[model samples]
Target chain A: MSTRLLTKYATPDESGQAILKNAMEKLDLSARAYDRILKVSRTIADLEECENIEAHHVAEAVQYRSLDRSGWAG
Target chain B: MLVKTFGAAVTGIDAITITIEVNVTRGIRFFLVGLPDNAVKESQQRIESVFKETGHKWPGKRIVVNMAPADTRKEGSAYDLPIAVGVLAADEQITSSRISDFMMMGELSLDGSIHPIKGALPIALQAKADGFKGFIVPKANAREAAVVKGLNVYGVESFREVVDFLTGRKEIEPVEVDTDAEFLKEQARSEFDFADVKGQDSVKRALEIAAAGGHNVIMIGPPGSGKSMLAKRLPTILPPLTLDEALETTKIHSVAGKLNGHISLLTRRPFRSPHHSVSDVALVGGGSYPQPGEISLAHNGVLFLDELPEFKRSVLEVMRQPLEDRTISISRARFTIDYPASFMMVASMNPCPCGYYNHPEKACVCSPGVVQKYLSRISGPLLDRIDIHIEVVPVPFDKLAAQKPAETSNTVRERVIKARAVQSERFKK
Candidate 1:
């Protein structure tokens, strides 16, 4: 949840682990909760009418769920 | 017998007179039929209790209350006193022919006191337009509504007083408001006195030009560089509200239930600074029933979005069209509502994520890429809409401590008012 972790580990191009991390904290979800982030990412993909959840879409969705405010902020 | 009277209810900013039909039937039940919100539905209990306290028999028969044009959702408890008065007057318990000449509105307490209702100015204007002799609203709202001339505006304290007045048992004087005084007060407080701000004279001059031209502005500054303080003061230096502009601004606040019952028109321009966390629905305004959002609330005034980059991109992006068109039209499957949002935008943001990236006296820890990315959070198209952009530097310690009677708001405001008058004359042409 630290800003440093977002800056260091999370890339704007990849989904990384922030979504799963958010689901764990917000939903007290287990590692299995990665699927929920995937689902949400899929929904956003559908909104854009994309054939699949592209790397950027998933990454954006994950960024949206970031517990570290810095990662999601512009 | 069914007795009918009409008073206005707001659907967004537009007010439509509702037909209040009270029928005292020959049964032992009471029914209120309308698409009333919980607040409106609860009026029955309030009305009946007031009846008991006033020593009037709650019509033992099946009493039916119908708010006609019922398809339009009726919210708020303002209808309670109207319906109560309608029932009492209909039953001939309180007799007065004057009821037909006036529009009555207020929320009734169980003990029969009238509580203030929102949108008094709009409702009063609507009543006047309908050619009603006068309007009877809560005493608190009377002054607000009194801003409307050519109409007798009565402010009543208790339901008993309203009942007594309407029945010719007592007389209530109509309220009067000093709109000129309100206007003069507005001319006195210039938004952010440029004199008080010691440094950043360039930024202040830019703001002055923006205020003069009615242009959107953005300020990029490090934390505690007086960006917020400057934004807050913009309204003071801007042009005063014309009577028409004041009425329009007052209507939006009324619909949002933001009017705090000053009982006079808002002569000052509005200044709305919504937090970044505000939802799209709350910012642009939409519901099962449409209400004004922040953009509409900021009409005829300034809408300051501080920490602009921190706001959700989607939420900020949605404002693009409204920013260009000066109106927001929210379309649902069933209905579409358009709210006026012709407001001057003044948004502020930090140079980087840490808010100290470009501080003159501080070290820059954030990389250049981080600064660029933070600025990119606010889309390019949105940035294009803003006419003025300036960077604010921190004031020196000496300037902050030295107060040799900085230029007061009144002096700066006079210049702004003059510029506004120029705009008004040009627009009229």
Candidate 2:
């Protein structure tokens, strides 16, 4: 017998993938930001009555990082 | 003739019934017994003066007043009305069979007017629990007692009115307050709103999250950055108080005598901002007779500590346990009492002693290690209990003067409610 990990929900579609990739490369987003963006995107999708995370949802979630204070002391 | 009437003694936010027994005999002296404090003992002079001014003759015979539960120390002048009534009834000035049906408490002025007494709510609650039909209190305290259902609360103006009501010459209507309707009607009217704040959208968002999750938050900023202003509006965005929470909070205020004769249910969340020079006992609640302090007074609401670093470290340290447990326990030699202290802690402090350590337009004057030392004054254990930390910067003039309206607290509150719904669903698993 083989053990397998359980996947709960469907993965994001192609447009969502493109938006996340663009945010990572252009904004130099870290892994934590990546997770936060996904969580926020899920919330945005839930708010918009969508069953899956969409590209516009991820874009809206990425804008919440303006308050991030990473390496501003120098 | 001998007569018995009832009053209540408050002990740690609860009330215990005290029986006042008055005996009039054949002498020309007066006596007051029981383990009463000086204030309770002083009720006799006030009662005598009140009776004389109200056109009632003081009994020429000897009078003896004994407060039951002789072992427990009764404090405060709340026993004045009961003692006076007992004397009047024993002297045959007011003959009524219904004197024992009501629990009466008030402080009597020399002019015979009834003054408000502390702990009316707890006394009313005890009356209801003990199967009393009605409670007679000062007009200022009637509504406080009226919050307790299944009990008639009579608010009287003078000792004459109490006499007339007891003798069935005049009927005094009990006060009535629809607690739920009043709470909903007044909860929407906050004096300070987030829309009035010109800028600081990020700080507002941080506050919204803190309010949603019931998390402790600390704001780090320089002076004139609107940290204190932002904290004051935080309560306006949090969830409205349920009727049970409002009653509980009102009871704590009633015990602390902070209601100041506003006898309505505390519909709005409390916002307590103690000064930096507050003592440890004043913050956490302790004394010879333990009373609710700032944290307990802020029950079901916000406790904002402005200039958090300036507070004595000892005072701040005393709040650590209650901040985690949401209740404070004060222990004495014979007993320990618990006061509900569940409050969201919102604190603000400048970055350094000079208040310009990290200003955008200004240079830092404090040395490198000074800022760290200033921050270190707030101990690690105290800071560990706070869940959120956000830094605030001054808003530019253009942002402040902009005509475009920012989001209101109601708008943020709606989103917060939805977020809380999601969190509750997730936590239910």
* Model 1 Cα lDDT, one tens digit per residue, B314-372: 99988888987899897877667778999989999988888887577898788878877
Per-prediction CA RMSD (Å): 14.0, 6.7
DockQ per model, Cα: 0.01, 0.07
Top model by TM-score, which number? Answer: 2
In candidate 1, list every pair of residues with a backbone clash. Answer: B27-B61, B27-B62, B143-B263, B144-B263, B144-B264, B190-B236, B191-B233, B191-B236, B191-B237, B192-B233
Model 2 residue runs over 4 Å out of place are A1-74, B27-29, B60-62, B422-429
**Highest DockQ among the candidates is held by which one?**
2
Q: After superposition, how far is residue B48 of candidate 2 from its true place, in Å?
A: 2.0
Instruction: Determine which window of 10 residues in candidate 1 chain B has minimal summed lDDT.
Output: B420-429
TM-score each candidate. 0.79, 0.83
Highest lDDT model number = 2
- CAPRI category for model 1: incorrect
